[model samples]
Target chain A: MSTVVVLAPIIVANWPVITAVVGAAVGSLGFAVVRGEETSQQRGETTTREEIEIDNSEILTSDTGFEEEIVVQREGVRAIFSRDARGVLRVCMEGRGTSHAELRRWGQELIDRVTQQYAYHRIVTELKARNMTIVDEQVEEDHTVKIRVRSW
Target chain B: MAKEELEIEISPSGKVTARTLGVKGPRCLELADLLARIVGREESRTLTHEYYETERQVTDQVDLYGHR
Candidate 1:
């Protein structure tokens, strides 16, 4: 062993990349995407919904031509991820009969998953770019991903 | 020369912990720094005993052999 370092992931990416990671995160958490066209209908049906923003996360988008939002639902709870005016990614949760605390927890979980996926993607891409080889990779029971890489 | 190895673990909450295996001296920090830049800011770092041992070995080798 030589050195050990701990890092806190910072997500700074374009729209498409962020969207793809968001999709993967949602899927991994058992959330199904609520299509753009059907989100309005879904929103209308949830009468007692609540919205909460996830803390300490922002996805920067270069394009300003259009606003894009990704909505996903799991067990009748909906999570909406969109970039605010400041280019800060915002996640809002909506669900009927769900307490505010529950919504917040779900929103945080989604953000956590997104951050993990983003970090994984960045690490793998960088390693490949540097001509490094991943010798082993695995996901632990706690959902933590371990990767071993070698370079001559 | 032995191959340099890096062991990286990304927790469920996305915090990353990386360790350099078989990499000696200051070169280990270089590898860790590269990863820090790729992932994000470094929260904390620990240099194991192995880190200093290599530097001491190099100094001893220099003392015995003189400048090449």
Candidate 2:
């Protein structure tokens, strides 16, 4: 080994790419994507809602004048992901019977998964663009992803 | 042709640690920079002993060739 580097991933992507990562994250966490109208209807029944803002994340879009949001539901808990006016990503979790703590935990989990998926996607895409081939890839018990790539 | 290898480990929290293997001198940093751009800002960087060893070998080779 020659050089080692540690990086903290900052999520910056277009709306469609952000949606894709959010979809992958929610799917892995056993959450199903719900239509915006369906989520709006479900919100009427929710009693408690907690919002968590993810730091170091931004949604880059040419048309930032419009708002976009994605909602996912699992086990009666709903998470709505959206970008604030400043483009920072936020998730609001709500459920009728779920405690605020539970909602917060679920929101945290979702954001963590989103960040991981975004980083993995960016790394793989950039590496492939540079003509590098992934020789091995594995996920550890702790959910850390290890990838070995080679360039000749 | 020589093969350059990079081992990247992304933690669950989305922090990335990348180590370049079998790459000599400053060339290893190029790979690390590429990853930094893809992921985010680099938190820290460390050059292993092998980096210096390779630099020494290259300098020695240059000296030997110049002496000839």
Candidate 3:
């Protein structure tokens, strides 16, 4: 008798096991559920613009409410998140630069730059063994010095 | 399942660093190579216990003393 060896595709293994597997995946990634299910920081503040766009100009809180903002008032680098009218998560980085595009570009960049300073980014740094640039120049924004990246 | 995680950061100065985790073997090097190709700066890397290790650490290259 002969035995056969096979290399199967590594999937979530599909449902009715899907829900359980998703839960496991979420838990592994250090996430908890509030409403009905799984994981991580989503950049949305489900509120009116008037509520989020206050004079302070801060971004809306994360879905899990585990959110943060770092602003260098003296050096002019600011990162903020908020939920727009459409209820999408938005991360906007503000800083001073020569042109509008330049400021926006730098704003997006500074977010990634400052992030690596934190503990989480530290793991990412150790894992990657190289720098990760979150903001690419492909997206264009108004010359407001605010680089806004959105997520669903 | 490819649970790969990557991170890169630059300080107030132009100093930059990169890291990857959960990616077994030299596959992580692909990510490092991509960043080096783009950032164009001579960056240094540190291998951690998350995925791999190095007999020697690549330090002393960055201006570590000037951490402001």
Best by lDDT: 2
Q: Which regions of candidate 1 are displaced past 4 Å? A: A40-43, A46-56, A64-67, B61-68
User: Which candidate order results from sorting by DockQ in descending order?
Assistant: 1, 2, 3
Worst 10 residues of 1 chain A by lDDT: A47-56
TM-score sort, best first: 2, 1, 3
lDDT of each: 0.85, 0.88, 0.33
Candidate 2 to native Cα RMSD, angstroms: 2.3
Model 2 C-alpha lDDT per residue in residues A1-152, reported as the tens digit of each score: 68999999999988888888898877878998887356634546646889899999888865754448888988888899998899898998888787899889888888888999999999999899989999999999988999999999
Question: What are the candidates' individual DockQ scores?
Answer: 0.88, 0.86, 0.02
Interface RMSD of each: 0.7, 0.8, 16.6
Off by more than 4 A, model 2:
A40-43, A63-67, B61-68
Steric clash pairs (candidate 2)? none
lDDT of 3 by residue, A111-145 (tens): 33222222122223333353333332121132111
Chain B TM-score of candidate number 3: 0.58
Provide chain B's TM-score, model 2: 0.80
Residue-by-residue lDDT tens digits, candidate 3, B1-68:
55455433333222344555455555566655654543433435544453343211323324454564
Ten contiguous residues minimizing lDDT sum, candidate 3 chain A: A1-10
Candidate 1 has a DockQ of 0.88
